[model samples]
Target: MKFSKTLINWYSINKRDLPWRKTTNPYYIWLSEIILQQTQVKQGLPYYDAFTAKYPTVFDLANANESAVLKLWQGLGYYSRARNLHATAKHIAFDLGGKFPNTYKDLLKLKGVGDYTASAIASICFNEVTAVVDGNVYRVLSRYFGISTAINSTPGAKEFKQLAQKLIDTKQPAEFNQAIMEFGATQCKPKNPDCDTCPFNSSCIALSKNTISELPVKIKAAKAKKKHFNFLVFISEDEKTIIEQRQGKGIWQNLYQFPLIETEKATNFKSFKSLIKDHELLTNQDFELLLYNKEAVVHKLSHQHLYTHFWIIKVDKLPINGINIENVRDFPVPILIGDFIERFNF
Candidate 1:
């Protein structure tokens, strides 16, 4: 199709010279794809450098400790991705003898490697003629062809993939795939797109009919439920803060954070004090709420919005039960708590 030629021509001159795009190294390609998920280019660039610099090979990453890996991925949300990356690296290094999977099916067998990621690595690194249909390709294809099916729907995703496959240049799959992705990201943005400069503007169904913004129909995501948390930053007599490693199945599982007390609703001052008074953890200690940290940050996840109230409490001595205080900083904590510590010198 002419779409492939047009896109490759444009990409040869306009595509961003990203570091990951400079080589066909499977490990670097895999790292780029994982980091780019749910993250913008500007945000993921530094992380890409840090990860590649620290662990130059699959073996290096495979042998790294989980805590060390999570610490590197602290600020980046979606801790599961980091864990999966570590696991996948270990599998490749130990099980496969440090050689990364060379095909799409092999890549898909690894943890956290979904269809999109598999296609990306297969085509970009190995020149496999697999279509890479990401958010950009979805938007560009749906709008250009005026497909109104919800992008997240099963049939909708399949239809888009077929259309993308038709446009992929079999001879130069890597350049052609990247070209379309770049075109969608730069010109056919979700907001006011630069249709005047877009090469497909004349033929684009959305641009011709003046419906650019609404062409890529998508199912609206469910509303996030509110969760109120009262985090007590208990500073011990020896200046250690109480921390615990989260275990079992739940949000933030396998991560570390300060001791938490969740409530059905937001607690007022009186109720908060009363709840602390009745709680067994603080009932026997000489704990006193010293100052209320005014800067309460709302951390939003895909399905939950956590409204955290940080209370700086002073305890004459640390609690001996239900909490671990020794070498708390050795374990990796959540980024929210890290930000709190940075702000208040905790």
Candidate 2:
């Protein structure tokens, strides 16, 4: 097809020299794909380098501690992705006998391995003809073909997937997938794309119809839920600090953070003072406020908007059975906690 041919030709001349594209190693490809998901290239590139440099192989990642893995993934939001990546790595190392799954169907069985990822790996590593559909592919195809279906809906996904499959260069699925995605990223971008110079501009339905800005319809996400977090940071006289590992089925699970007191909305100073005075553990006269953030620290997640305030309290004595914190940097913390710690020299 001219669309695939022209796009592939453009890709041959314009594709970026990414590290993952240099090898057929499924291990590296899997890492890159996982790290890049819901992440931008420039932001994720350093993390990919760090992971490959430290872990080096699937075996290394599989054997490494969860804290270490999550620490390396510190700034990357979506802690679940890191957890799943580690789980899948161990499964491949122990359960699969260090062999990467060669087929799209088999790869999908791995944790966090969905259709797009499986297809990318299967095509790039094993030369499978599976078509990969991602955000980039959706935008490119929708604009090119003037498909207005909501890409997130079930029917829209199926329609786009079928269209992509039909247009794919079967003999070179790997290159085709990469080419279409790259085209979307660089040429057929989501906004303000330079269509005048595009190879497909003459035939692009969206460009011709003056609807380049809104071709790929997607269901609007619900507004993020707002939450209030008041962290009580206790550092003992001997430089010991209190940090607890998050255990619930929420954001930052398994990551460390200060002792938190959550409320429905932002807590004012008066209510906070009463809470501190009434609480059993906090009312101990031995502790004094060292640092209190009067300004609301806002942290925005995908599904939640957190208004955080930190109170760094100095304690004269460490409580009985209190956890010992030697190095603040040793623990894996959420991006919000990590930023607070780093900025305040904790």
Top lDDT prediction, candidate number: 2
Which parts of model 2 have CA positions greater than 4 angstroms off? 278-280, 321-326
Query: Which residue pairs overlap in candidate 1's backbone?
Result: none
TM-score of each: 0.94, 0.96
Which pairs of residues collide in candidate 2? Answer: none
lDDT of model 2 at position 289: 65
For each candidate in the order shown, give its overall lDDT on alpha carbons.
0.84, 0.88
lDDT of candidate 1 over 15-114, digit per residue (tens) = 8989998889999999999999878888999999999999999899999998899888878888889999999999999899988898999889989999
Which lDDT tens digits does candidate 2 get at residues 55-104? 99999999999999999999988888999999999999999999999999
By TM-score, the best candidate is: 2
Worst 10 residues of 1 by lDDT: 320-329
